[model samples]
Target: MKLLPLARQAEVTNGWLRERLRAVLPEVMRRARVDLWLVVAREYNEDPVLPSLLPAPMMGARRRTMLVFHAPEGGAFEALAIANAGVGLDGFYTPMWDKTMLAEAAEDQWACLRRVVAERNPKRIGVNVSAEIAFADGLSKSEHDALMAALGPELAARCVSAEEVVVGWLSRRLEGEIEAADGINALAHGLIAEAFSPRVVHPGVTTAVEVAWWLRERARSLGLGCWFQPSVSIQRRGEHLGDLGSSPDAVIRRGDLLHCDFGLHYLGLATDTQQNAYVRRLGESGPPAGMVAALAKAKWQQELLAAEMVIGRSGNEVLRAARAAMARAGLEGRIYTHPIGYHGHGAGPMIGRYDNQEGLPGAGELRLQDATLFSFEMFVEHALPEWDGQRIKLATEQCVAFRGGEVHFLGGRQTAWHLI
Candidate 1:
């Protein structure tokens, strides 16, 4: 899994950003009924959505950078960048505060923003302020007040929360991006396979913590970033099934079931995967029949969830439908799936929370749109006859993309355990 050099990575990201702005912005604005959208961020305190909008090389916002998107219904779309100096965004955004165009250096950036809005006179002015999604609520209190003062009363009256456009723009994935995610997910899967093998884990010698750190170090060795710490847990024969597996220091042993929750960040996309491994005891060919059956049930739960991920269905609606199906199958499970991309728990509809299986509140109410990526994360419990009918939770997670009204697993899912 070779990564592109920093310069090449920047080129690829900038290209993707350009395509997104040109192809997705206008339609998203129209769908949200927003004629104008403003994204404001300062140098250190930048908006969550700002990095996604920025070029790859530009790590953070310059001194008080503001992005303006003017996309009216049945009209031309304009992307404007208001900053004190050039931020290498010439082709992507039309510069609003270019030094050459200025009559004097004393002009304020906010004043330029006011002038731009006055000329456009858009009916609906969308701002990055929301009570629901944090990704859409990027505008700071001071910035909001200053914007209101700059726009004055009448223009400020048209201000509205840009949740719809923000979510739509952030969640939507292009064909190129989806393709990249497929490869990124494969890299993560490969790393997990290597870590679960005898080369890294030795029965009775390697502790769960050792394997977890190995995963983290392996990712860094491959030049990959991890959004969260890698976790490894053990489920031995006499342990409680629902105890979230054994502690981090639990040692690997023959006939023990191993589980890991790992994620890697690469190419501006994140891949989250939870997989299971079984240590083969002497003279045993594979896992016990009961353990195998439990794994099968876990796969079935994944299918049930996938079946309900229909286009335009709200996250809560999907969760309800999937749970009903699971109940009909008589399987006990919990699902806490989420959209994944730039951020690990990326911006989009949140299906269910582990603690609250019924549904989430604000994010769950959002509908699942096409061209989005999600992590199929969940667990199912089943009794193992080999362990005297002790119930064990078999958790599995894999990256998937929903496009063209269909669900495509980024890399093929784990149907069988990685035997160590």
Candidate 2:
């Protein structure tokens, strides 16, 4: 599927974003304990926070642009870079680039960065580099080696981790970005509902693979992207994550359960949703007695998982709470949720993986930030004694945001599945 368009590039005014940056910059500096932040990258290499740092007009990274931000003990921050425009840092930065000097100084990126560091003169320097988060691994290995050699041992020793600052910025959602994300999520429901209709899925005709490709093609037709590969499966009687039977070789039969785990990407935002559908027979009124009960119990488990989202709490806290709630309710389920944003699987506050829920160092350590977006992802399986006697697994995903100390669903949660 094709990726959806980015938001229209608009004029940034002296508004909340500017004010928030002013407040956040100093706070980040103090927390990170770094007087200066030197973001060094050649063309095509950018800081994980580069999009947030740059002004609207610059699309791709410019050559040898080193953004420098410093907060002195007595005054406002000093914002400048090796370019004419200072990444909206003009309020606190002094432009230090001259066309004549850059043309004659050297063709080397490392040499230029060293000169700027010597001129700026700050105690501590912070660069984005981390072992846990791939987003922070923007610095190329060769570039890192060159930087250390050119800056000398003393200056190189000043580098510190920018993980906390990166997490704080990425997890904290902006107003415009939230609105766009919400709209994109709502569009996902429409795409799936239409794809599951009889027009695309004819009983005894279309295979699961055919229906899956149709979903991807339909999304491409609507000018959007899929977060991962779209998956479609039919759970007849007995199915498991390990084995879902002989891969839908048989035709779609009456009273069969059609389950799908899919989502679409719109406006640069990715969504994850899973849903179930039942095929009606010649005189059957609705889904079989057993499948409905199993789905109901699964839905109950969904509620238990969603109710635990809290603000200012670590991923580990919410995760433990969800498990406790699940045990109290006597539901068998698994939770594997992650942060979703500008990049899919974005970059903060990971709840728990299906396999590893005991806790992770950097992953589970991040606390929930208000206004942050997350995909409420998990699964529930229940056994039915009423029908032919089998277990059915139900999974659904919806976008939820932590705002004002509470979690609110973006559009709405699916209570019942759409019948095919």
Candidate 3:
């Protein structure tokens, strides 16, 4: 695959940021009942939303960077950057502070922030603070104290947590971003295919760890990175491999069933995928029918989960519906799907968890929205007759997007085992 030049990539990223700010930010603020949004962060301790808001070339937050977004009752919002003049936010944000301006004024940046807030006198000012979502809880104690001090007691009273706004902004994917993510997901699938093939795995000679590192190295070679370390594990006939150990020395042998959990992070989007592989034994022409049947159950569970992702339903509600459907179909499985985009385990509602499959308390209450992407992650446990009635866990996670009330698998899902 051809890669974009650094300059071109920056241009694309800036364009996406501009579009998202224009389209998503205002609507989210309005829905969340916020008239003003303040995003402040130090240099290295950047907020999660900062990367999405910043211009592409500017990798991290600058010294004491403060972004103030003001949306009035009926007009277009204003984006103001209270930081240095030339950090590549010229078109998107109006510069509110510079070194020369600071030198002229006896007051500091906080004073300028106060002036901006006092001018607007917004009824509701949104800040990053929440107990439920970590991505929305970016404000540090010191930063919070400084903000309260700058705004004074009365104005600070209007401050509200921006959890809803931040969640909406981060989870909604623009058209261009969705297209870019499609390419990234396709590349990830191709890399996984290569890793499972004979080119990288030499049967008994290669180890699971070797294949895992090969996948990581392959991603690096393509100028990409993995959000989590890639994992490859074996599930033999009688041996129940608990925890799927990450040891790099577990050798790959014939007749062993292989599973991989991998994800790639590139161009501001992340993908989480899990695929299986089967090695051919000396006399066997293909995997046993019972093993194939077990995989079919996993696919069926995926379908059941996808069918429950209605537009306005909460994640917990969806979980209940999916479980009911699975019960009707006589299938037993666990669903732990989550949104994936800016972060690997991205913002929005969490369907279920590996440990807590009943329902997540606060996070699961978040309703599903359109134009959001998710990792359709789940597993099915069933007895395989070929393996002496031993039950196996067949887990699968594929990147999918929900738009126009339809769920589309980004770059398609893996239905058949990747034969080695």
Best by lDDT: 1
Tens-digit per-residue lDDT, 1-420, candidate 1: 788988898888888999999999889999999999999998899899898988867888887888999998778999998875556667789888755434545568888999999999999999999998999999999999999999999999999999999999989999999999998898899999999999999998999889989999999997888998898888889864335533467678999898998999887889999999999999988888888899999999999999999998999999999999999999998989999988999899998988998888899999999999999999999989999988788889989999998889997789888999
Task: Show how many residue pairs clash in every candidate, following the order shown.
Answer: 0, 2, 0
Write out the backbone clash pairs for model 3: none
Q: Estimate each model's TM-score.
A: 0.96, 0.84, 0.97
Residue 6 in model 1: lDDT: 80
Q: Which is the better candidate, 2 or 3, if ranked by lDDT?
A: 3
lDDT of 3 by residue, 1-420 (tens): 677877888888888899988888898888888999999999989998898898878888877889999877797798898886676677889878755524554457899899888998999999999999898899999999999999999899999999998999999999888888888888889888999999998887998888999998988888888999999888878665545535347678888888898999877889999888888888887888887998899899988988999998999999999999999999888899999998999999999988887889778999999999999998888887887887778888899988888888898778888888
Q: What's the CA RMSD for each of the models?
A: 1.9, 4.1, 1.5
- lDDT order, best first, reads 1, 3, 2
Q: What's the distance in Å from true for residue 138, model 3? A: 0.4
lDDT of 1 at 297: 98
Q: Give one digit per residue, the lDDT tens place, for model 2 in 33-71.
A: 777776667767776666656554455466666677777
Off by over 4 Å in 1: 99-106, 240-247
Give the runs in model 2 whose Cα sits over 4 Å from its true position.
1-30, 42-59, 62-65, 71-74, 77-79, 83-96, 99-108, 118-120, 238-251
TM-score of candidate 2 to 2 decimals: 0.84
The 10-residue segment of model 3 with minimum total lDDT is 98-107
TM-score of 1: 0.96
